[model samples]
Target: MLETLELLKISTREQDRVEREFNMGGAQSADKGHGYHVLRVQENSPAHLAGIEPFFDYIVGINGIPLDTPESRVLQDQLLANMDKEVVLAIYSTKEQELREVPMIPNRSWTSNPGDGLIGLSIRFCTYEATNEHVWHILNVAPESPAELAGLIPYTDYIIGTPHVTLHSENDFYEFIEAYTGHPLRLYVYNSDFDACREVVITPNHAWGGEGALGCGVGYGYLHRIPKTNKYHNSQLTYQGDLKQQPQQFNDQSLPVEKSHPSMTNTDVVTVIPTTITTAPLIIETPAEPPETNRPQQSQQYPNYHQTIHFNNDKVPLDP
Candidate 1:
């Protein structure tokens, strides 16, 4: 217990040196420099399920003491070098505020706070593209998705739609991803060949975790697919004189040169379509009053800070 207290005292001093008040981002500073802070506590992360997020402004000291910063990197470094392997965090647990010392034993993956009652949400490594074909084979929007919720559907390739969806580039597919963050969109899709078409709205929800957070859809890689579309031909070709260009034929039928891409995707996506809530939904472009700019801070002193220490914990002193 004495040794643990000493470590805590040292860690607290380090945290104090780094954590500065008045940051631009939301809360999550306590376990700042320690390795534990990397495992974010978003409602979805394992840490969050373990009842982490217990307090805010984890700034225990300044330059080897407690404090936050005014949006600068120097101060950030000062706060991070003080952590090691014993800080614990979560939403709720036996110990309320302050971290409960945890040994730096690898694979100590046990949390008292049950866990995120498993679900079937599929996760994958992927990216999305924008193509006319993607928009051409149109259909209705998927309800409860970002697209549909945005009040737009993959209908008649609206080269122009509200919410101002734009093509970021012919190469970077994640271009429109920014459009989905904090905003939802509804989509309508279709495929002439399959004689299948439907509306399914999709939204991109991402969060970063482990001490500090990044965004949703963890364990993925650099996604780079162009967001493109294909030309929507109303009528299929009858006896074609030049359809030979399409070297590939299905069921002995000449096919069109397949040269179109798709849009916003949920990769390796494992999902269970929810029951279509009241068919008619509302889409607010600019509500009379926009939603709160930032979420509410749970704690008092210097709240509104979210976790973010993108380094491996090694700065703290070794116990003798």
Candidate 2:
């Protein structure tokens, strides 16, 4: 039997002005590993009320915003200009292969913080070119950690630098935090969602009822590790051979204390994909650092590094 289906025609008109908060639903860039789809949706949001499913809906246009054109950034800027107002969204569903119009108002009345207004949503420029290197992906932020206090967004922000040191690896960041514990340190961060970079100041401490000095989890791996640095800015996008090599040497003229890096113990390594997040880290037995000998040996991977965490069934803070 042949099934006949008729397309339902519906008005794109948005009803009454609810004066609701401004938001077009939260979204994450498809260029940054996440496919071009809605990533999140706020409760009772306009996008929610309209039944826009996250992780599935792909936005092709909003009102008059052009998504796939070269002037896409310009269109995004215009969309921002209409904040706290009603707008029409053209969304496509890859699963259903159907196009529909979603009418919604963008507002920021949900979030209590006024400075964080405009929209309770996150968005990023659609770019797949890896131009971000020497960056740290935040795995977890403790309940009341200094990182959480500083408004550092997990899974969205990438930690780049600390005051005078260029962090090359996870060890570098861990070592830097230990040296600056209990002291205010300026950190450089990149917000992948906003396609912007900013500086945030945080004081690392152990009194926050957390495990490590910073009370946050960070790691380097295939999915969540540092990315390549972009070197293109001119018209003719010439191909650069490679990004500058990351600094491997650590020099701390400011901090007088010195510590040596510890070696991992002999334990069967187990790799598991954590259920909370998709970061699959290898669990290796970390033994306590051997007592510092008066007779100095070869230079440690990171001088003056301390182990404040271990691999357990609980959240494993990757510092090795």
Candidate 3:
């Protein structure tokens, strides 16, 4: 507490209003090839009542911020640990293509549930193209208020990207989220693109801002009832991504490397070995005067010139 307060005093940005959100990439996950870890489920959360489950990956962007490092994990954890926190979690489940968001503090307060603080349904992605290969199907319908009272199915795909549950159409984006009029919901995903899926629920804990609907949850994340591989972005969506490396130490790296090229090796071949048999390298140091030095450098391959001119006395008899 004292440490945080002391740091807050010296911080350039206001500590209280500093924007905080969900975590994504980290060394822990990266080294393990798991990427960043998110708050899948808190012990107690409002998301539980609405059928939101834990272990689902956070998929959406928060506070217009995108993170590619696990340091983001520390930052997110810090925010939740603070009092009266607000964040937006993009929830992804194995079930659907659409999205659901569990916001710490929405611009609009859309809830009136005494126990349930969220006035909106927490879901996965909400947008899609008919051209998409697969879709998440809503599965079960729990008997209760709102959506259950209305004629909706647990087998249909929840619209992507909003709290409102509306029919698919060729219209504006916001026009789609206008479906849910603020109610808790449970959706079963029918993923056409993916192979298999398991059913899970998300429950939002409002400990940080846990004043019911009046307060958002503490550790907010992308609340995907049905986790997905992609975001509701304008591009191809997939969980596969680049590695998140920790910031390299500048001075540490700025200094010269303690080693040389990996290809180069410390070998005795490179080193000049001292030998007592130097004998001038079996080489005549400086040639005497010109011609005296211009002797046959390399010996003839076959033999000396004398060998080719065989002048035998016996051969002379035949030449007569």
Candidate 4:
């Protein structure tokens, strides 16, 4: 009984250590409550020098005390009281998916501007929900444009974030791209089609015979969110034919004339059905005959669809 009691105590101590390391009791989860969400970190400042990241990183605790309270003044008062003293900040990084302790001494001398905070960090007290759902959906990529050259696929790709900085708003990506004009910028792109994430390097330039720097139409919000696996189905073509049947032999004179492309043929119908439990099967019938005049291929098959340039704007609204 004594040995069992000792084992239980050891397990409890290990659990407590894990909780403190990851700030498990703090605002790690949306249900847990709120924390100081780092909005911006000024260069050469105490927070910036201490590797405090913006947007993705949150100040969850200070000096072993969890800052999970909804009151912003609690954090402000604590920081003001601890100025010039070396304090350990419990920082939760959404990008790295880890919680770490950052030690720094907050001082007003870091910046000449009195308006700037002692740590030179602008943070907001908000609930932190660890999720990768926030992303910019790629709607269209202009042909011969920087986006196209960088191999950005429309309707399948999503800009999750950048490795250097976390993107919090819709304008964040555009502003980052504009800042890196003529310079290469790395992006974390997630594709629903492949159900995978990849790093893509793209250079934004206005000389690509396009309207926008990257010449890509990006969207955000619910409608633009990455489709759930069950709701989305990649178009697959299945050839129904007898394996025993020999290849069709055609004489030079009796050869069948090609009426239109195989895609427009009624015999080869591609039915894309949604795998969602609540949704019905979506039936898409192909046209029997092709158009008389040459028309552009469908957006799903090709990325040549016309898109209105919105990258020039300072702010792009999120999709409802």
Candidate 5:
């Protein structure tokens, strides 16, 4: 078994080529370098049964062997040769930021499709970056849409990830939103204008009379990365401090006003204050209230329309 697996090993030159092609920054430790990113894991398959999660997991090694090869055929060949035999896969979780070993026996009977691999997983060779730099840039959010209602700001906000799941690919965010359709999915969003991270809850639904579930256009890749400037860094800290103090100030003001009005019962006064304060941030940050004369003419053209917008040769459907 050991000799058969040795065939999967590539030359040192080939390994270097792999690193260069994927921009993995040369040789890295066994646990933190290049690996095959799991894009999809078929249900009831060996990979899924072994707790391999799609989009957030990477297959780094097979049978204690690090898969540093450029081509995915190396990993496929190893699995095919080790069929029916218990093989240990070195799995890396992007969410947990850890490496673990999962044992599974590959077989063709897992799925009805004849073309399905023994492991039943779709993966692509890529470099793994242990950073929260990746983000989905919000482009246009439809008026009265779920995204707008949830406080997502177009061209200003970026969806980083959720509390539990760390988004690895562009499709990860879309898939997550679909999974939580009709249910609230809390996301950690960063604003370019504020340079701050905050939690936003969005309930995605198809009944919102929009083309997409969230009614928002999100762009990924290098162009959408967060700006690396300290221009707003100092202000972000000051803004966060102000946010904490605002609630206390509102509470103090509301209590005295409630005492002044004895006719307006305690329950009515208490409910009004909480609702007003909770939505205060959204009201203040809303971009719709700006005068059209002050804004650009092109932005006003698609005020209530949803259409495709091309960006760098890629077609992105944007809602306004």
Candidate 6:
């Protein structure tokens, strides 16, 4: 999880700035006893600009109306009620480990229908459980593209949001681009290699002479999926494609040329097909000894002329 803390301020002086398609300073709440805990903060939204982070901040008060009632839905109700007015929030941050006041104003120009909250925040009926429901994996980024200019790394970064829009799949990202064409897209992404999340802004435009609006290819993946460390092996291992992890030593004879790349992505790496492998064993041998030969010779005589004979070999006779 990201451990950074920031305080953001957004201006709603003009009514036009207050309204957009996905216009609620991108903040939602979950039940928190008398108060409500922040669950999601849209990227570049008013909530995000005000430094409101989901799961790490709790909303204890709103517009000076202390959300201390037993009714858990009170805060969401009150915020939705004052959709077009200045709303101040009392927030507690786990990163800062303190309480602070944040100001947010709803700028929606369109009147919300009955039971409709258009401030970009989705109210959660249950406890907020962190999961990888939204993914923004950049499969390929074109040169001189907005994504490239924004420093979006391909195959390593996960896109989480576009200002107030939370992207979970490629279709969501596509729809958001089509709906908000030519809008300055502020993106919040989880970098797998860094194990950290970061924010980047890319203005979607077709004048860049690219195929797509952003000139980038993206796919869906789990947010929690991180790249594994590298390992090196002596004699048995060889350098292949990009090496993102550390190196280790091993005795394996060969690695699959296609499947043994260094980087481990969330998509295809998991479904890699195994390749054939072979092993080599060690062996030893010894030369056989020549056939034994014997030569007899008399050495000395004792008591009645005795003769001594010996065999010429490394081994001695049992009798000797």
Tens-digit per-residue lDDT, 1-320, candidate 4: 01121211324453354454344335442223345665445567677677665545677656545555443233455566777887666566543445555667767787776545567665545555534346678987889988899999998997755544444544444555555567776665767766555667788788999777888887766577556442101111011111011122211111011222122111111111111112111222222321123222322111222211111101112111
Clashing pairs in 5: none
* Residues 101-170, model 5: lDDT tens digits: 5667788777676544577565545656643235668888889899999999998887655533444443
Backbone clashes for every candidate come to: 85, 11, 67, 0, 0, 18
Residue 46, candidate 1: C-alpha displacement in angstroms: 9.7
- Predicted candidate 6 versus true structure: per-residue lDDT over 168-273, tens digit per residue: 3334444445445565655557665654555576777768887777777766333323332221111111112111112222221111111121111111001111
Of models 2 and 5, which has the larger lDDT? 5
Instruction: Name the candidate, 2 or 4, with the larger TM-score value.
Output: 4
Q: lDDT per prediction?
A: 0.22, 0.39, 0.24, 0.49, 0.49, 0.39
Local error of candidate 2 at residue 166 (angstroms) = 3.3
TM-score on alpha carbons, each prediction:
0.19, 0.33, 0.22, 0.42, 0.40, 0.34
TM-score-wise, the better of 2 and 5 is: 5
Error of 6 at 193 (Å): 2.1
Worst 10 residues of 2 by lDDT: 14-23
Q: How close is candidate 2 to the true structure, as a TM-score?
A: 0.33
Q: Which scores higher on lDDT, 3 or 6?
A: 6
Off by over 4 Å in 3: 1-43, 46-51, 74-78, 105-320
Model 4: residue 184 alpha-carbon error in angstroms: 20
| TM-score result, candidate 3 | 0.22
The regions of model 4 sitting more than 4 angstroms off are: 1-33, 136-143, 146-320
In candidate 1, stretches whose alpha carbon ends up further than 4 angstroms from where it belongs are: 1-6, 11-16, 19-50, 53-146, 149-320
Q: Which candidate is the best by TM-score?
A: 4
Candidate 1 structure, TM-score to reference: 0.19
